[model samples]
Target: MNIDIYSPDAYTTGIPHEQFKWLRDNDPIHWHAHPEGGGYWVVSRHADVITVSRDFKTFSAEQGFVLVDDLPGDILDMARNQLLGMDPPKHSPLRRAVITRFTSRRLEQLEPAIREIARGMMETARNIGEVNFVESLAGDLPTAVIGSLLDIPRDMWPQMRRWSDLQTSASDPDLGGTPEEVNNASIEMGTYGFQLACERKDSGADDLISLLINQEVEGESVSEAEFASLFVQIAVAGNETTRGLISSGMYELIQRPELYRQLEQNPDLIPGAVEEMLRWTCPLHYFRRTATADAEIAGQAIAQGDKVVMLYSAANFDERVFDNPMEFNIHRDSNPHLAFGHGIHLCLGANLARLEARIFLEEFFREFGGIELTGEPAFIRSNMVHGFKQMPVRLLPR
Candidate 1:
C-alpha cells in the first residue's frame, strides 16, 4: 500500500494504525519516499527502535539532528548543542552535568510544590467554570516548572512557552512562523537566558541556571554561547514535551471514562496509569537519526547519510512487544515504552516529566470529581510532536 505517512494531515486523523500494522507485519523496516524530497526508513518494531537508539554509532542523532525535515542553519546549530543532537563523549559529559538536578529524589522533593502548582492551575480553571485545558491548565505546569528550574522570571514564562510552541510546531501553518520569525524568537529567548545566567554568576542563586553558570566542566567554565544553548534545551524540551503528556493524558482519560473512573477510585494506580498514558500516546511520534555509514536494518540497506526515523508511536504499539497493543490499559506492567526515548540520549527530564504528570493527575482527580470533554480536542498539525493543541473540558468540582 502506498501511504503518505510523513504528511501532517495523516497525524490529525490520529495514529496511522492501519499503515503501521501493515509495516510491522510485512516490513518491520520499511522505506518510504518523503513528499518534500529524499526518503527515510521507518523502523516500527520496538526491538529495532531500541537497537537503533542504543547503537548510536550506526544511527547518529548528530548527523541530522533528529528531525525528518532538514532544518535551517540556525535551528540546526541550535539542535547540535542539545543533548539530543550530541553524539557520545560530548553528549555524555553535558548530559551528566544536568542529570543530578532531575534525579528521582529531586523530583520527589519537588512533588509537593508541583501539587501546589496544579492546585493553583485548577483553582484558576474552577473560577472560570470552563476553560481551555491546553492553555489555562496543562500548558502552565511545564513552563512554570521549567522556569522555576532555570530561574527565569514568572513573567517571562508565557513568552518562553510561545517560543517553544513555535519551535516545535514548525510544520503547522497556523502555529508555525517564518524562518526569520523563528530565528528571532530563539535569539530573544537565548538572550534572556544569557542575561539570567550573568545575574546568577556571582549572586549564588540555588537553581539549575546558577549551578550551570557556576560549575565548571572539563576544568573550564561553559561558554556564554554553550550556556545559551543549554538554556534553550532545558526550557523548550521540558516545556513542550511534558505539556503534550498532560494534555494528551487528559484527552485519553476523558475518552475512556472507564479508565478515568478506575483511576479516580484508586488514586494509587496513577503512577502506572501515567506510564500507560505515555505508552499509548507517546507524545513524540518519531525522532530521526542519520545513518553514519552504509548500514542494514532488518535486511533493508540504508546508505550513508540517509535518514532513519525511529517511530516511537508505532514501536510503542508493536504487537510482538506489547500485549493487546492498541488497548490503553493503566495496569499494563513492564511497559518499556520509549516515550522519553532510550540509551545515551534518553531524556534527562524523564523523572521530572513523570513526576509532573503523576502529581498533576493526582491533584486533578482529587479536586475535580469529574472531567468531561465540552468540545472537540484539537491535535497539533505535526508529525514529530503528537498531542492536543486545544482541549476544551468542564471540571466538575467536588
Candidate 2:
C-alpha cells in the first residue's frame, strides 16, 4: 500500500498504524515525495529516529526545524531563531540560561499551585455533568500554569489560548483560521511578547520572561526580536502539546474502563500510567530536521540539505524496542518514549508537562467517581499535533 503519510489528510481519518509498521519493517528510512517540492527521508524505527535526533552535526534544525514543506521566507527566518530551531554553539548557551527554571526542583515547587488550579477546574467540571472535556477541562490549566510562570496577566490568558490553538491546529476546521488570520495571530502575539519583554527587561522579576530578557548569551542579553520568537514558542509549545497529554490521555482511559479501574485502585501507579499514556499516544507525529552533511542511515544515503523527518508516533510502536507494542499496559516499565523527544533540542518543558499530566490524572480519578463518554471524540486534523479538538463526557461526583 503506497500511502502518502506526509499528507495531513492521512491523519484526518486516524493514525495509519499498520502503514507505519509496514514502513518500519520494510523501509525504516523510506523516501517520501513532497507535493510542494523536495522529498524527505522518513525515519520510522526507534533506533534510527534516535540516531537522527542525536547527531546534531549530521542533522540541523536551523536549516528547517520539523517542517517537510518549506515555510515562507519570513516565517522560516523567525522559526530559525527560536530555541527549537537552532544548532549547537548557539543552541546550548541559550538553553542553559533558562534550563534551571524548568528543573524538577523548580517545577515540583510549583506543584501546589498546579494542583490548586486542577482542583478548581475539577470543582467546576463537577457541576456540568456533560461537557466537552477539551474546552471545559483540558485546555485551561496549561495556559494558566505557563501564564503564571511568564507573569502574563490572568485576564490575557483566554486570548493567549486562542492564538496558540489557532497556530497549532490551523488545518482543522474545528480550529480554523485563514492563512491571513494565522499570520496575523503570529504577528500580534510576537508584538505582545515584545511588549512584555520590554516591560520586564529591568524589573528584576524572576519569571521565565524576565530570565530570557535579563540573562546574557555570551555577553549580550536576548534581543527583543529573539525574545519575541522565544515567547511565542514558550506560550504555544507549553500549551498545545501538554494539553494533548491531558485530553488524549483521558480519552485512552475512557475507552479502556478496565485500565481506568486499575488506576483508580492504585493511585501510586499514576506516574507510570502517565508515561504509558505518553508512549501510547505520541502527541506530536514527527519533527523534521535538515541534513547538514551527507549521512547514511540503515544503508540509505542522504545528501546535505535534504529534509529528514523523524516519525515519533510510528517509532513508539516499534516491536524491536517495545514488548507487545500494541498493548496498553500501565505497568509497562522502562518506557523510553520519544514523546518529549531525545536530544539537546528535546522538549524544554518535559518535566513540567509530565508533572501536569500526573497531577491531572491523580486529581481527576480522585474527584470523579464515574465518568463516561457521551459523544464521539474528534481529533485535530493537523499531523503535527495529535490531540482532541472535542471530547464530550459526563462526570459523576464522588
Candidate 3:
C-alpha cells in the first residue's frame, strides 16, 4: 500500500496507522512525496525519532521545519524565534529563563486551583448534557489555567481560545476561520500580548507574561515581539493540545468501559491513564526538523537543508519499542512516547498539559457516572495537529 503521510485527507479520515505499521516494518526511514512538489524523509521508528530530536546540531529546527511546505517568510521569521523553533546556544538561555517557573514544586502549588477549575468546569458541563464536549468543557479548562498563569483577564479567555483554535485548526472549516481571519487572529493575539507586556513592564507582577518580559536572555530582555510570539505559542498550545488530551481521551475511555471503570475505582491510575491517552491519541502526528548537515538516519541518506519529519504517531505504535503498541494500556510499563517531542524542544507546556489532563479525568469521574457518545465525532483536516473538531457526547449524571 502506498502511504502518503503528507496528505491532510490521510489524517481527516483517521491516522494512517496501517500505513505507519507498514513503513516501520518495511521502510523505517521512508521517503514520502508531498503533492506540493518535492519529498522529505519520514523517520518512523522510535529510536530514529529520538535521534533526530536529540541531534539538533544535525537536524535543525530553525531552517523551516514543516515537511509538506515551507512557511511564508514573515511567518517563518516569527516561527524561528519561538521556543520550539530555535536551536541550542540560543534555545537554552530562553528555555532556562522560563523552565524554572514550571518546575514540579511550582506546579504542585497550582494543583488545588487547577482542580477547582476542573471541578467547576465539569459541574457546568454535567448540567449541559448532549453538547459538543470540545466547546463546553475540554476547550475551557486549559484556557482558564493558562490565562490565569499569564494574568490575562477572565473575560478575554474566550477570545484567547478563539485565536488558538483558529491557528491550530486553520484547515478545518468547521473549527477554524478564513485565511484573513487566521492572519487577523495572529495579529490580534500578538497585539494583545504586546499590550499586556507594555502594561506589565516593571510592574513587578509575577505572572508568566511578566516573568517572560523581565527575563534576561543572553544579557538582553525578551522583546515585546518575542513575547507576542511566545504568548500565542503558550495560549494556543495550552488550549488546543490540552483540549485534545481531555476530549480525545474521553472518547477513547468511553469506548472501553473496563478502563473507564478501572480509572474511576482507582483515581491513582490517572497519571498512568494520562500517559496512555497521550500515547494512544498522540495529539500531534509529527514535528519536522531540517537537516543542517548531510546526515544519515536509520541508514538512509539525507542532504543538507532537507526536511526530516519525525512521525511521532508512528513511533508510539512501533511494536519494537512498545509492547502491543496498538493497544491502550494505562499500566503499560516503561512507556516512553514522543507525543511531546524529545530533547530541548520537548514542549514547554508538557507539565501543565499533563496536570490538566490528570485533573480533568479525576474531576470527570468524580462528577459523571458515565459518558455516552451522542453523535459521530469529526476530526480536524490537518496532518500536523491530530484532534477533534467536534465530539458530541452526553454526560451521564450520577
In candidate 1, what are the lDDT values of residues 1-398, reduced to their tens digit? 87678988888867888988888888888888987777889999999999899999999998789888887787788778777888987877677678866777877788887888888988888888788898888888888888877767788888898888787887778677987887787778778777877778866778888887787766767656677878887888888888888898888888888989998889889999989988988888999999999998877888999899999998999888889988888899889999989898888888898899988888888889888889898888888888888888888998
Clash pairs of candidate 3? none
> Evaluated with TM-score, which candidate comes out highest?
2
Assess candidate 2 and give its lDDT: 0.87
**How high is the lDDT of residue 125 in model 2?**
91
Q: Per-residue lDDT tens digits of candidate 2, residues 1-398?
A: 78589767778756789899999988899889888776889999999999999999889988887667777777888878788889998888778876866877888789999999999999999987898998888888898889988989999999999888788788888786998888778778988999998888888888889977887867867878888888888999889888888888888888899899988889888889889888888789999999888889889999998999999999999999999989988899779999988998899988888898888888988899978889888888987888888889999899
Candidate 2: the clashing residue pairs are: 66-288
Single out the weakest 10-residue window by summed lDDT for candidate 3.
65-74
Q: Clashes per prediction?
A: 0, 1, 0
**Candidate 1: C-alpha lDDT:** 0.85
Q: Please give the ranking of all candidate structures by lDDT, highest first, separated by commas.
A: 2, 3, 1
- Estimated TM-score for each candidate: 0.96, 0.97, 0.96
